[model samples]
Target chain A: MKKQRFDYGYILTLLISLVVALLIGAGILALTGHNPLVAYRALLGGAFSNARHIGDMLEYAMVLCLCGLACDIGSRVGIFNVGGEGQLLLGAIFAAQIGVWLKALSPWLAIPAAALGAMIVGGFYAWIPGVLKVKLKVNEVITTIMLNTVAVFLCQFLAKGPWKNTNKNIVAGTGNLPGSFWLKKLVPGSNLSTAIIAAAVITFLVWYILQKTSKGYEMRLTGDNPRFAKYAGMKTERIVLITMVISGMMCGLVGMFRVYGAEHIYKSTVSNEYYFEGLMVAMIAQYAPLPTIVISLIFAILKIGAMGMETAAGVPKQLYLIIQTIVIFCMAAETGIRAAIARNRERRAAKQDVKARKEGGNEHA
Target chain B: MHNNIWSTIFDPGTFSQMLRSATPVALAALGGLMTEHAGIMNIGMDGMILMGAFVAAVGSYFCASAAMGILAAMLFGILIGLFFALFTVKLKSDEFIIGCALNTFALGVTAFLSREIFGLSGTSGYAVPSLPNVTIPLIDRIPFVGKVLSGHSIFVYVTWLLVFLMWLFVYRTPMGLWIRASGESPETLRTVGKNPERMKWIASILCGVFCGLAGAHLSLGYLNGSFVEGMSASRGYIAFACVIFAAANPPRAYIAALMFGFFDALGLRLQSYVSSDLTGTIPYLITIIMMVYVVVSRQKRRERLAKQQLQRLEP
Candidate 1:
């Protein structure tokens, strides 16, 4: 039989699972002697409480979404690019260095120059593992993870030794770039700049490239079946290599945004586990770009709101991390839960058929 | 500067230090090799080690006994192993994703729980007493070997013993045969009425136990009974690499781990004299280069094989 087009029931299942997760989170908060209602209200109010807060959330979302997209590319190609933290870190350094060295250039020229530099360097950083996978068959997971360490060292060396902002009499950061190089802030009373527009545009472009292009189609095919694609004469090796390069470029964009738009300097601390969080966001979105953007915003909101939750309810903001972990556990455990449900339904259906025949016989009698 | 660096790198006292540093990686790698041999790719060794170390510290802290701490750590490892087996073996989930999830889960859970339980952010200090070093009488007198072998923590000796034991277990025993068969011939093992799934579970749990011990060694034996957030770092992945380098053989894995330890010790030594930051980057740099080298060599091998096949066809 031809199947019906839409399944409202499936949508309802997703909505219910989300609600259940939130309720469990609220229960945990209550057990900790904090009023979940007050905390949640504070979270909402704090995140969207003002224009400035909203701007911060947007900027944060932009950075995370780019990183998430970068990770999704690698993940789709069956490469776990755990090196987002490293790639982003290095990208920031490259972009900031360009901004620093070319301080005399016009804002428009220098900003794009810095962004391009970041993409190149970031993409190169990721290409190491891609090439290795194609050549040596060494797992990208280990290589990407190792590259993270290398990236951190490279950042530390630049920050402390050569790129140290010597003029500031402190050795922790790079020299600041010209104010002109900074991306113009679009929104008043918020650092949410025209950069958000750039982010949105890039996301759109990425979506187009992934969905509408033959290269993207080839990439998806290789990701799903490299051997089959090779049989189809698709140059699977080149596709694998290019996919990683693009992934790395996305990471570079994330780094460039953080430096040019927000921090305006490269620091070692930026090499933190933000990349892993980006990976988690990508996983939750199931590697779909649009969903990833939405998930990134949700993550940013939760992180931004958690502070207000802490102050209003006297619950530690670390509890937000706990909630995140629980959500991940729920996501990972989803298939198992659905299987159990399906098994139970099958058994119930079998019993119902028997009972239906008995009732029909009694009615005939 | 050259003299100072060379002296530090080649110092006689450095041998003992190297043993101390290498013990953790070697133990974890040895543990990972067991599962890898059984065709179970264990990426959660780091998480297992982290969980083991955290529990060891917690157990020792309240009980005030290092032995009890180690035992508790083992139990934690078993639990994590079971969780891993449930995902990879039973549910047929992606091992890589599950491993990543476990690492993330461990990081969050440990950090949050550490805060709630100890009112500390990353670690609990003085959770258990540190394991004391034991000097073997005959081995103590054997010059350089004695220096490296004797007067080390109990875990150090246990690690070496476990390597030998693992070698024997894999080569000499029936269970070892089953594990090998499971990885190489799953269908045949099933035909023999042995469940490959069960064997994989056993291997994973065993791996977990070793991982737990590795953690205990880090916290109670090495760090003087403290639980630190992200203490496992990327040692888990490094150990997995060691498994690959060793060709999934326990003895070879131990040797590969020692290589890591040698670099780790070299870094520590260099840190004493050079910039700490530069020295700290050494081990990570080596790991990257090593993996890349492995990849390059593998490519060469594939090309050579293809060339040989073409020559054969030409005849």
Candidate 2:
């Protein structure tokens, strides 16, 4: 059970799994009477073809990066906050409410106000499960999952009922926030916003907090060995609460990106898949903040590319989910693959020892 | 309208709605109990149910048979069960993470296939042959009982039977002991020349099958030949919570699911007075509160036991 160095063999296995997944996707397309190559070409072209496509993909990446980081932080503290969807939705709800309420403010003031409002809401939402988990030993997983439905329903109620836009059609959502409250464009003529820049900064800040600070050390210690941390005089309960709240707040920020930066409305139709997809990106990245950014970027391509494939090549956008599933299955089985390799090495070593003894005995005799 | 919600609960119509709503959850809870007793919590029930919902519809839509749809769902359920078993039980991966991944995968794959095959994002009505409601002649003649129980799809009756069967299987049978033993002490089972891992695999697959039927019930029996994105919704998770609430006991789980259903039916009725969206939050809020109560009571019991142990030491 000694720790082995980074195993290239495991990486090879992951590569093979990816190939298998791609081949399966291709085969299915072919069986359904579509050319896989053509479909993939269209996907890539649509996701990366022009400035607009690039901007859209980046926007997705930014949101995913933040959400992934949220889940990653929670995991580090051994809390499975599967209710990221709920937290994200709550953040969006707050952002929309606050953004509209303070529409008269300058862009800088309104932007921070909306984002801060979202973070606080998301944090408080997550705190419920965290407090329950620490004090009463409630399974955070179930509580989080249940809370997700609760969050969405609440968002829907607010969007469609009280806060619903009378100016807009029958769709259940608030009117767009004033244009002044919108996050400034990263490029003046493009769809891209400073949100990506904000996301990047937040990721770095999270990384710094997780790796460098004393608080991060305590949190990681609590996650690695709660009993040990407790014995060492650390307040494990407080750590758990802090980690979960921060994770939820990060999710809230991602919601703000969509509501205040991109969509500019409190719509219940926000992609519920973002929470899961963000978690998937984090899983692929092995939960490192920097690598999370890269994986999220890759995931954004898959997401946007699939939509493009749907429009141009008549392939379903959901094919990417299959690919993502395969990736998860492959990654989740990494330990098994590692164990197999380790066993093979031990068996060969034993065989070599037997042969060496035989030769030594013969020579000595 | 507020009074109407209470009135609806007392009426047979609401009872029918409650039973219908509870059927899928009860079915899935039976499966969830297996995994819970086997030492693995099956969160992937959501995905399995989704897969079952999609595949069952595909089977019926193509073959024009309700039975074929259920069979198709069960088969796909087995496949998902195998994969879940392989990753969690066999590979030693985190069960919760794998379950979450499976749910996402199910949503993605089903959405993809639905769009490709049916060219619809949501609500393909009667894409397959709908299951017929069976009215028992004798039972239909009984006043209130008849109105409440009769004229239900076959799954409704099947769920009632499944609860009893599951209860017997988990509590009475030797296999049931082994499954429970696996969760309690897999090492002890191993010492007795039994493979605890194998037991877990069986329980997981059975859980898959149960959730599959639950999903089938949603598409064919409840909604009757409709396919939509997220049609399974949060029922799988709700069933999971029922398992926790019931402590993996079939009868308790059944009752718990009924309560969940009762709330759902009440919420639907109450929606007439309140915002439909607001009422939708009722079931989730109630579930969370139920969990909180269970956890707090459990902690209190543990504390009492600890106090007793300390008193013994002092004496």
Best by DockQ, which number?
Answer: 2
- Tens-place lDDT per residue, model 1, B88-152, is 77766667767776787778667656765676554543345778889999988987787767888
TM-score of chain A of 1: 0.86
Candidate 2's DockQ: 0.72
Clashing pairs in 1: A136-B295, A186-A193, B61-B127
lDDT for each candidate structure: 0.78, 0.84
Give the range where candidate 1 chain A is weakest over 10 consecutive residues by summed lDDT.
Answer: A1-10
Q: List, residue by residue over B57-151, the lDDT tens digit for candidate 2.
A: 88888888989999998987888788889988888787877887899888988888787787764546345787999999999999999998999
Fnat per candidate: 0.44, 0.84
Candidate 2, residues A16-53, lDDT tens digits: the string is: 76787788889878988899999989989979987778
Model 1, which residues run further than 4 Å from truth? A1-42, A167-171, A186-191, A269-271, A310-316, A336-365, B120-127, B141-143, B272-274, B293-315
TM-score of chain A of each: 0.86, 0.89
